[model samples]
Target chain A: MNGYLLAGTITGVVVGLVIAAVAMTFTKKNRKEKFTYDERQKTARGEGYKYAFFTLVIYNAAYGIIDMSLTKPWTENMTGMMIGVCLAILVHVVYCIWHECYFSMNEEPVKVLAFFGIISVINVIIAVIQGLHGELIENGMLTNNCANLIVAVMFGVILFALAVKGYVKKEAAEEEE
Target chain B: MKNLKLKAARAAMDLSQQELAGRVGVSRQTINAIEKGDYNPTINLCIAICRVLGKTLDELFWEE
Candidate 1:
């Protein structure tokens, strides 16, 4: 309703649009027109999802207990948003590790891990900036709600970039065979 | 330095990087990186390559 909220909303939407555009461009450039999931990739993804789900449940339970002890409710929007994004990132990291381990047995794992590390640092910087500017929360419940939205967008963008790079390398190898 | 010896050996066996990768259960880029000396393969991958090429590990991996 206020000017700050309006500005945060606009910023979040713009960031989301830019990230979506970039993802589309990468997918178009690298992948085949048809979509196909390799059996190995599927199995790895399934395993990763399982890890992510367990992580989310455990984190939520622990955080909920802590919040309750502090006289805070677990149903708050800000806490929910943080938990959701953290779980999403956990899932993605698990998937990346699985895919790399299965398909790139001879390749260094540090390369993919480094990429994720960089993205995480960037996300933290953004969150800190947004929080400092008071654009992320008011009264501890995400009055603006835009910073979390931007983080979700950025997560999707980074994941898409990783997928594109992986698929491109796979296609290049297939061509040589 | 480029791995001319590896490239030559692979050519002698009529194997592309993709074929070698398939035999070794790694991505082709891993094989390409090894051939270009951009990456060093693990001991397991080295042994796999030796097995596929029917050469001793030293013959396939050692630097002269």
Candidate 2:
């Protein structure tokens, strides 16, 4: 077993699950609220995104510089890509959780879960089909190990869309008025 | 910058932030934010809060 791939896969999946668990813990099933954004949540989320954005920018740049300057073949540290992405997400999660606005932003937690859950199932199906055809396994048990990271990217895009929608709701409302 | 007037109104009506938020079909945090003046509610939301608080928009939102 390749240690780098093992570590990379574990880092991505563990972080993704931790985020999911934390997000789900904030759901209010009985509250029956349609939209979760209020005044403060929108502000907090905006600020969180701002910080997360800059954090990732610097992180990615630093990672690239360090990877090229410090590593042997540049791909020697897959963690450059894998760990960097996870840490970007970690920054946003930590910021949101700190502000107590994580729950408010992830208003439709069930919808998010369902959407990603279906995609996850589909990824598995593709993996199985590819595995049967002898495609997914490049070396042995460590190839194509970034599946969780791929899912996380998709999930993050949808969540970003929701945040954008939430941020613009008031403006949209005013325009309609 | 808390909207003490709105808070006072809610208190006068013997309602908690959670109750008002529930009645307005919003989260308690929304109500809390509104009372704290940290978030500006939309006109629709302002109207909703007003309706729930038994006050006009001016009474609750307009700062005199």
Q: Which candidate leads in DockQ?
A: 2
Candidate 1's DockQ: 0.10
Q: Against the unseen true structure, what C-alpha lDDT does each candidate score?
A: 0.62, 0.66
- Write model 1 residue lDDT over A1-177, tens digit each, in one string: 578756866786687588656544444423444323333444556677777778777777877677679764534554465656666665666465435433233333345445444555676777777778886666655443555545545555566656676777779669856
lDDT of 2 by residue, B1-64 (tens): 7898899999999998888987886677677767877777778888888888789988887788
Model 2: DockQ score: 0.34
Residue A68 in candidate 2, Cα distance off native in Å: 2.3
Model 1 / residue A76 / CA error / Å = 4.8
Per-prediction TM-score to the true structure, in the order listed: 0.46, 0.57
Judged by TM-score, which candidate is best?
2
Q: Which ten residues in a row have the lowest lDDT in candidate 1 chain A?
A: A29-38
lDDT of 2 by residue, A47-73 (tens): 888887887799889877866795343
